[model samples]
Target: MPILLLGNKDIDLISGKRNITIRRLWKQPLYRGDRLFCYWNILSKEREKIFEAEVTKVKILPFKEIISNSELPHKLGYKNSKELEKDLKKSYPNNTKDNDEFQIFEFKKLHVTQWEGSAINQKNMIIKKADILFDMGEYEQSSLCYQAALEYDPDDANLLNRIGDNLSRLGQFGDAIKNYKKAIKLQPDNEYLYNNIALVYLNKGEPDNALKMSNEAFKINPKNTTILYWRGIIYEMLNDFEEALKYFDEVLELDDTDPDVWNERGTLLNMLGKSEEALISYDKSLELCLDDTKDSNTWASKGNTLLGLQRYDEAIECYDNALKIDDSNPIILNNKGVAYMELDDFQSAIECFTKVLVMYPNNPDAQVLQEVCLENL
Candidate 1:
């Protein structure tokens, strides 16, 4: 029987469910009629045989199509399909037939493995606690726990990488870089680690070094879309707008449904003073967007482009759409006020600016704009 290790969340899988598990079973010697054994909480050494299941069916499909499924996202315990797809793309870009997209392993979970709980090691317990903290957005506390866990196994590259990721998010750029370097020393070809280091360099305002690091990662995984996206970002940071656009265009060619790439392309076009072209790209991003896909930001960007083109009414409508998503966002309110002012609607402009002033008490620009509106009134 092939052992199917589970996480704490996977207990729900065995009781009586049939959610498709996403594990690399290509290397496993298995056929459709094979019995797959299950163990719950295996990572913490909880080698309890939970249940057994017969593999009735198995189909490998491209991740792009898999992520568009509504039920699959919740079954996989993801907030949304887009988020799940992004993660899969980053982790399993080489899993696809094309070697550019993710290949999802689809199977039905049948029965429990029949064993329960063994004591988890102290190190794993600490690591589990750290993972919980990290999930709760307590990066500092998580980093401390991860660091503490490191005492049990000083040479753990995964631990070092996790600590480095936490430090990077905490804005400890120097420490983050040190931890990433340590991980690299232990595991020389971890392309994701190199990419992580590149992000820190970008944060430190060193686009040159960021590009260099991204290039190194590219050498390792030439077809990773995430790395390609980062390269485009680095180029944008370095004011190489044309190069950035080219990379984003390439990403779109590979996967046109990715709103992030479209958004970046729109931003680059906007920077290049191609307002109409920018609007088209922004619209494409919006059209590709799913429910609650942060359309407010895209709407706001489109509004800004229209505002530059002096289409004040259209801009105001776009701003209104943005406000519907986040009614209390002061920045959007301020922009809407400016749009109203451009249309010579002094009353509406004053009302919008007043909202901004109330939300952000020290907004000098809003106050000044409100004063102008009052004069026009």
Candidate 2:
């Protein structure tokens, strides 16, 4: 069977938004009327058959000719010719030249019953849709899709776990726990199910219950970094700072590249009054983070550390960076106000406090700080 492996970028093809695909010529090139089995090559190395299609047309063109055509690149899923050229070079470094031949395959999707391979699995396709929705942060819609998928495979433990994840994201903690428990019943040996249960409990502010689930996961796989990180969080919530630090350190020793673990370690060190050591950990976390916006909390935490060290100007800069990503956070705004007050910049401090007060009218801290700034001025 001729297979067509699609990446995340090709998801629109499954939704019928796209019908054309450009590729470097395969050794056994697809011809008109050839049946193609399309599957999503997920990041987890799992391939889920999305659809089967019949090639309706084939056009052969040189690489340069394709890039030179404005409309052609868009039809092939690129924003423009420049993007198409860059991707072609990266995808086929050795073959992508001005004269290299490429094939444009236009295909029409076949209904499930019309497929030549094993009938398209409706459950898997729904799960794929749910996963995409989940990644897009449409938790409610993703949960509905996962629930619909359950009708096809009620006993699928992984599907149950995914539904649990969606529910957790939606803040439906009780229902999330029920789904996770159901998954655990179906796949008792899966440590991740236990880990999911722990996270739900953690979110619910039931650290004792979270610890119980974490311990169960630990018994299954003590060396797992994820389980260890959660154990540290659970311990921190229980106010066992020393024990939490141990677990965080254990996680770092095993995999030092995790920015989240480093951030957690920094928080723990700061709580323990080791401000200098905490600064180092926060810096490490920031260095490991690739996207500044995604690590806004780390930036805010670093600001707190700098404030503790009496580096008022540097602290304000860190808070400013965090505010650029999360301007609506009143706590960050108030902290920035505090930093300005520490530097004796009353006007700037008042501006920060006023912003916080605007967001949270009943914020007593902001009100008091703004009043102090006014009195100082």
Candidate 3:
């Protein structure tokens, strides 16, 4: 099953104005008689099947020769060779050398009645749809699509892994592990399959089991940073702080730009009562963080470190920054309330607790804390 993804050229393709598509040579080159599944890749990451087409011809030509042919650019719906060259460079920045080969696929659109394809093609189509759905965060729907594809090719380890991923996102840990284990059985040498199983066990609050699976992945690829990072996380969940810190340091030495690792290190340091060192890690995490949600978590963690250092005002400032990004987090709200309480501002503390209680009516700690604030006033 050959799939052709067109970006911003669906209208031209449908209108028959563009019959040829030039692409960098794929691992599997298109044949003249092959049925191509044409898809329009929308800017929002959505993919729509425009139509099925048959490859009428395929021409393999060097980049220099293709650019020298002036008439070919107009046939490709470009105004001139320069426009085509610009588009090609933008699409394939690394493959613009004069000697680089490009495949020009000339296709003819088939009628809806002529769109019937093989069972394998149908499986590929379903997998493509499932991939798009997964990217869109429709995990349940994507899982169902993957299941349908699995019926057609049950032995596909990649399909099993994809199904496991969706199941994990949906919090179906038991089923996720089942799929992951199935994948592992099929591809025992794949370290990522073992890591996936470890993650499922970790989510199920079984860090000991997670560590066993993670250790298998580590054995397969000891230098893999992802495996090292997960090993660090598993050790943290098992309360083996020293071992967790050791792995975290290993990861940082390999890739210092990972904000999540820095944040985890800060958390582990904070738990060990090293407030000053924790602050440094938190600051590093914040500096590297690009996501607002992660930035909020790092800020909240920094606030906790400041609070432990008895810097109530600085802690409150950090809490305020965290709240600005995620005002509804009850844990942060309660911590902010505690900061206020430490400053002897009982009324402000009560307000913070009240906000938490409003969001979570059954929050016993917030309820008790609010009463204590009232008692002080």
Error of 2 at 303 (Å): 1.7
lDDT of each: 0.78, 0.88, 0.88
lDDT of 3 by residue, 282-374 (tens): 999999999999999999999989999999999999999999999999999999999999999999999999999899999998999999999
- State every prediction's TM-score relative to the real structure: 0.66, 0.65, 0.66
| Ordering by TM-score | 3, 1, 2
Clashing pairs in 2: none
- CA-only RMSD, every prediction: 17.9, 11.8, 15.2
lDDT of 1 by residue, 1-377 (tens): 57777654443353233356665435664567666666655346555554456666565555556776887777666778887777666656666333333223335544223223333354576677678768978788678768867866899999999999899889999999999999999988988889999999999999999999998998998778888899999999999999999888878777788887888899999999999999999999999887554698999999989989999999999989988988888878888899888888989998998888778889998999999989888
Off by over 4 Å in 1: 1-118, 290-293
Sliding window of 10 residues with minimal summed lDDT for model 3:
8-17
lDDT of 3 at 310: 94
